[model samples]
Target: MERSTGVQAYYAESAERLGEVYESVSFEDVHGALLDLLPEAPARVLDVGAGTGRDATALAGRGYTVDAVEPVAELRRVAERLHPGSGVTWRPGALPEIPGVRGPYDVVLLSAVWMHLPPEERPGAMRRLAGLLAPGGLLLITLRRGEPPVDRRMFDIPPEEVADQGAAAGLRLLRTVAEGADRLGRDAVRWHAVVLQLG
Candidate 1:
């Protein structure tokens, strides 16, 4: 699948700025709503779209083995430098077809990443994510809710849409957190966490 041109251009140009912005927030603060759903430490994790290694490094600190998949070279470089010796393996890949990364992870996280996928790519991405989960593993997808930025490609995907697609992929919808305020202080932006389990 072709990547969104806006996503490519924007991240490439502003990777360092975005990295600083994203790393400023603690992972726990951002994912507080779904903390209860996380499996205990030592569980394998896949952090897709791990822009700056913030989430992946935090999970590593908590003793989870994390493989962070990021498609952008600039972001990956920034992430690795920001969290050296973090024990988080950086992989080059993206959604719908995460090339070079094989998984049966205990947890798969797509934080603020789903919105980047166009509508036509969602189903395939959902199926691919489901396929990467170990039996009974959790798939935590955080959906961004807000207007798309004029400079970058994004969609305010609804939780219902994710849940439906997950179901079609044979995943059980375990939980859906109500939309919460954006941690970045964007007035119009909010977030919803959708948790699914592999049968």
Candidate 2:
């Protein structure tokens, strides 16, 4: 997939800043709405666009095997160094065409990544993600809402759009929560999170 230079630079040039933001985020906070849907311990997890590996590291600490796919080189380097031996295998990959990452994961997570794709790309992306799920697997995605920042590439993606895409992908909607604030305390930013169960 061809990535926008702005999106590339936003992550690469601002790795340090993004690292600090990701460092403060917790898996519990982000996955609270979908906890009940997640499988039991020792479940295989795939965290796509896993920034800084914070959530992957946390889940790995609790005995889950995690495959964290981070496409950014600098962030992957920092994440590996920051959370080594956490039972999390960090792979370099991205969405819509998640190359180099195998799936059938018990849980698939996409934190703050859904909005990065253009509206038309969502259905195919969701289909690809759904195909990666194990039976009864859960797919959790958080869509960033509100106006996009000047530094990065994003759309003010709506939760309904995501649900529609998921439905087209043959995923059953489990939950939809639209009240999360920015973990970095960005007032201009908020989140729309969704949980889907694959057939």
Candidate 3:
């Protein structure tokens, strides 16, 4: 929960709009590259920045136990309302220091949320993410690349940088989908999925 105040406010005020926009894309479509890498059902999964519970709900439907962490209150409300009885627990939290969450999850997912962490915080954040994983657990991180929006804070983090940081945190690089077209059809935006594993 160490993100800046402005980012928090932005998500809070835009939660409704964001919920609609985020849910427009199906989980399979958004995460197809790494879908096969997900652990089987009954495994514990943590979805950070789980806006509107799109992925969390979908994962729950697949029979996995999911804990969804969202920083904005409005988004959590929207998520619960949109997917009632989804079997996914929703909580307020942020990166580098996720509070109130019991970890050692089989899978940890961060979709389109890592860019907000300032460069200096990435190493620490990577370590924290690593610590949250169980032995041989998977850490799936989706990076949004290209120019950032004018209104919100973002960084164009390279995949190599993340891989290096993960390695420094004792994670082994497992897979890297170099780039994919933006599902939202934004020409300026692309995505990269980096999967790491703890020994």
Candidate 4:
């Protein structure tokens, strides 16, 4: 997919910022959500657009085999360095073109990554994402529910839109959760976490 140069630059900057914030993020919600879908036993997982290895590392620490794919070279390097001996494989590439990672993944995670794609490219991307899932495997995605900077086209698509797109991509929506606004509620981003199954 062709992105405007301005959008590319905006992502580059955002990737750097996200790398810095990865460690500080509260993963409890995400972990709880994943556990509700996945079996207790460790499973092979793929972290799509993994920014700085937070989720991948956490999963690996729990004995799950993890392969993390990140497009930003700098962020990939940072993740690799931070998680030395973490047993998580870090690949530098984007979604739909994850290098050296074979899937049939028990879980494919697209956290905070869907909104980065140009709105027009999302369905195709989701289709490819669905293809990576093992039969009955979960495709977990969390989209930020608001407009991003104008230079970049961040998809602020609603929950219904996401469900519709999931159907178009041959995915079945198993669960949808809308998080409450954060403390202060002003400019607080609400997140839509959807658990999808590829039929």
TM-score of each: 0.97, 0.94, 0.97, 0.86
In candidate 3, stretches whose alpha carbon ends up further than 4 angstroms from where it belongs are: none
Q: What is the lDDT of residue 106 in candidate 4?
A: 86
lDDT of 3 by residue, 81-194 (tens): 999999999999988788778888999999988888998888988998998999999999999999998777888988888899999999999999966789999998999999
Candidate 2 residues 1-62, lDDT tens each? 11556786678777778788778868787667666776779899998888888888988887
lDDT winner between 1 and 2, please give it.
1
What pairs collide in candidate 1?
none
Q: Among all windows of ten consecutive residues in candidate 3, which has the lowest summed lDDT? A: 1-10
lDDT values of the candidates? 0.90, 0.82, 0.90, 0.74
Model 4, span 116-147: residue lDDT tens: 77766777777777778888888888877865
Clash tally for model 3: 0
Q: List model 1 lDDT by residue over 1-199, tens digit each.
A: 1267668778979999989899989999999988888889889999999998999999999999999998888999999999999999998888879987788899999998998898889999999999999999999999889787887778888899999999999999999997678898999888899999999
* Cα lDDT over the full model 4: 0.74
Candidate 4 has which clashing residue pairs, if any?
none
**Residue 173: error of model 2 in Å?**
0.4
